[model samples]
Target: MLFRVITLFDEKKNKIPATIVHGATIEIIWTSIPALILLIVAIPSFALLYSMDEVIDPIITLKVIGSQWYWSYEYSDNLEFSDEPLIFDSYMVQEDDLAIGQFRLLEVDNRVVVPTNSHIRVLITASDVLHSWAIPSLGIKLDACPGRLNQTSMFIKREGVFYGQCSEICGVNHGFMPIVVEAVSLEDYLTWLKNKINFDFNI
Candidate 1:
């Protein structure tokens, strides 16, 4: 447009095209395009947000707790032998102690386990400071605020390992906090639960 204007008005000093001060067509075009684009984009956004919020009668419920530099998880459903729920803490692996094929600063001593193709509920909270529980593959990035509880639901579609890290800058060692999720078949999950139950019982 600038080159065209320069070529057209090269010999004229004061000759200029009149500007469209008030064109209803231009106004409607400008207004309707973005609104139509926004309407198209919002359909999937609202669907995903509403789907994440829906609980859908989850088969398992997991409670997550965040501290200054570590993450704690609790299996809060379907335990009968013990009054307290199954709980454990996860910490990031040190560089020197990392095993072969294990990702440094991403591996943890414990991994949160769940079953594939099943609905799961996660309740998040912080014990001392603010933290965020984020898993990119699962589209989860909920805040773990102190004195308040936040909840979300997830459904693992396949059996695999997913990894994430603490996204909030709560303290100096915040980078050291990592999260790992192990998704397995339902039979394998029950076997793991049995083994875990026995181990916790023995402990």
Candidate 2:
């Protein structure tokens, strides 16, 4: 699509004769074309945003609290959850902890976990300075402003570990806070959750 647009402009520039057409026609032509293309993009984007609130079934709910240098995750509901509002602190992995295929300053000790294809809503806030929760693939990011709760809904379509980082500068360790999301199959997620609740393992 982008190549087509650029090629169209190049061809227009080459063929447009100064003696034949006025500049206003060129402006109108480009303007209308882009407007029509923009409409094509805007409709779907708006529809996706509007459909965020709609969910089939949510198996878990998590609350995230951003502090000076770390992130805390809590399981707020236990209908299909496994943990006592467990708080897991996510810290940036240091150079010593770096491994092959792991990101420098982008890997965290603990990652936020969710089930693939499950509707998950994240509740975000800050304990001190403001921060932001962002995950690109899942298309979620919101301000974790102090004293205010921000919400975002997500439905993971794939199973893998996706990473993000703190977008807001909070304190000295602001750059050290990294976000990781582990998406797994629903059965595996439920099994892990059950194990976590049974004190089988620290998930």
Candidate 3:
């Protein structure tokens, strides 16, 4: 879908001869074609949304906190700790440790793990400044305000790692904040969650 939209932009930029034979006709054609295409696409989008609304169960819930230099995530629906809830901080990886096919400045140390085919709701808010949370594969981007909460939803269709970054400028470290999401099987997610919950830090 992003490909189509981006291609459309390219087409618009490179379209037609500058010699205007009929301005009125060109306006009508340009306006009507995009509207017609939108109508064609809106039908399926609406239907898919309505179908998802009928799901019977809530799969998972996560809370995200954007800070000056890092991001923190918590699984509110899955309890991992009694006194302290299960949470972790995600930091961007340095250039030397980055791998191929991963976008530099957009890879994190710890990526959030969720089960595939599960409805996941993310609640985003900033701790001290404004930021944005976005994932291109899922087509979701929401603002993270200091005193306000933003919510967005996405269901991972496949199991893999996806990357994103802070879309809004906050401070000196704004470019260092990264978001990584890993969609895995339910069993694998449970195993990872257990490890996260029981991690020892008493070095």
Candidate 4:
């Protein structure tokens, strides 16, 4: 299309016509075509941008803190940790300790477990240096800036394990920072929460 529109002198025509070059019709056709194409594309792009920025009432909010080479997670829905811990750090699984089918640098000690078919908000921040909490399968990559919070949301449709890593070059052990998120059913998630948190919810 570019060649046809740009190259006025084709195989049949050797020299370009002066009227065709200076005509208003040709200029309008060339200019309006790109403008029309851009208008056609801008509709859906703006819709997606607005939808991503939409803030819905989330059932659970999880806080993620990025460290030098690891991540810390806190379940914001529960503050029942007086002595028993409700927050934990996730460290990457070493190569030797990896199971047969587990990934080499993708697995972590504690996975961020969430319920499927639910709206979950994640607040990401960094403690030591700048980091990025990214999950490829979920299409989420939010920066973990120190002393600042970045928010993102996700709705897992099915039960699966999503993996990610620190995309930013923070320090020497940046390659070791891996993240794992496991989505389960509502009943299973509630059961896991009960067992993990040991707090009875009046749901």
Candidate 5:
């Protein structure tokens, strides 16, 4: 229809018909087309927002604390740690300290461990400066502000090591602070939890 209208206009020396120029069709077309397009786009957008906000019965809850050039993780839902939670700090592996196949500035000494196919809630906060915990594959990017707690939900679909970084510029060493998430099987995660609990207990 548009092609035909353009062709007609070109053939008729840019002249428009009197009926079309004065018709209600142009007004209705302008309004209804945009409305229809918005309706088409809004459904999925609203669904994604609702999904992001919705928190299900999470099997585990992890608290992440952003510090100066490093990240700390605590497994708050682990009942084994009755008094102290299973907490550990993750530091960036320098280029000289990196092992074979390990990425420089991207690898960390410790990785955030979780089980696959489970609903996990992550609470984020900063100890000093502003930071952002983001993972591209998981589609999560949350701010870590001082004195304030932010939260997000994650459900790992598979088992792998996913890497991210402090997206917000907190300080000079912000580039060195990296985030790594290690998703394992349920049994492996339980074994890791037990080992970490024992290690913390011994300490």
Candidate 6:
């Protein structure tokens, strides 16, 4: 119907009739249809935003500090040894240090480990410059601004290694800083966490 109307208008010689030009039905259809479509789209869009911002009772909370060319992670929830939290710096593995079948510029010396099927809260901040802690597969992209803490939540549903990089351009070595998240089963994660807290193992 719309195509035929457009065809009829295109075939007209000159002086388009005011009845069709200023038709109330046409005006209402154009305005109301787009408004209705937008309303439909906005429903799910707002729902996603609210879901992303919703804070659940997380089992573990991880603090991420972004520096010029590296990322530091802290497991502060279950710190029992001392008042200080368990902290580690995750650096990009150099090309020469990479093992067989390892991805170049994607592997890190340490990976941020979290248990599958657990609600995890991540607090992100920058020590020096602005950076973005992003993971494409998990749909997380958070800004790391100096002196300010940004919070986000994640619930890992599967066990795998998800890779990401700094989305913000902080410095010349910004590309060198990559993010790696290793999601494992709850038992394996607890074992790894025990080793991390006890032996200071970089797992």
After TM-score superposition, the amount by which residue 47's alpha carbon in candidate 5 deviates from its true location, in angstroms, is 8.5
Cα lDDT, all candidates: 0.89, 0.81, 0.84, 0.89, 0.90, 0.91
Candidate 2 stretches greater than 4 Å from native? 1-57, 79-83, 200-203
RMSD for each of the candidates:
4.5, 8.3, 11.9, 4.6, 4.2, 4.5
Steric clash count of candidate 2: 0
lDDT of 1 by residue, 1-203 (tens): 99998886675765675676798998999999999999999999999988768798899999999998999999978467566678988988788988899998899988899999999999999999999999999889999999999999889999999999888999999888899999999988877876776644321
Model 6 lDDT tens row, 1-203? 99977877673544665554477888899999999999999999999998877678999999999998999999987665446688999999999999999899999999999999999999999999999999999999999999999999999999999999999999999999999999999889978887877744333
User: How accurate locally is residue 181 in candidate 3, as Cα lDDT from 0 to 100?
Assistant: 92
**Which lDDT tens digits does candidate 5 get at residues 1-203?**
99987776684674654554465888899999999999999999999988877678999999999999899998988765566788899999989989999998899998899999999999999999999999988999999999998989999989999999999998899899999999999888987887877744421
Ten residues in sequence with the least summed lDDT for candidate 4:
76-85
Question: In angstroms, how far off is 46's CA in candidate 4?
Answer: 7.4
**How far does residue 182 in candidate 4 sit from its true spot (Å)?**
0.4
Off by over 4 Å in 1: 1-52, 199-203
TM-score, every prediction: 0.73, 0.68, 0.67, 0.73, 0.74, 0.75
Kindly indicate the candidate among 1 and 3 with the higher TM-score: 1
Weakest lDDT window of 10 consecutive positions for candidate 6: 11-20
Clashing pairs in 6: none
Q: Which predicted model would earn the best TM-score?
A: 6
Cα deviation at 83, candidate 5, in Å, is: 2.7
Give one digit per residue, the lDDT tens place, for model 4 in 106-132.
999889999999999999999989999
| Off by more than 4 A, model 5 | 1-51, 199-203
* RMSD in Å for model 5: 4.2
Please estimate how well model 6 matches the true structure, expressed as its whole-model Cα lDDT: 0.91
State model 2's lDDT.
Answer: 0.81
lDDT string, candidate 3, 58-143, tens digits: 58888999999899998876553345678889999999999987788888888999999888878899999889998887797899
Clashing pairs in 3: none
Off by over 4 Å in 6: 1-51, 199-203
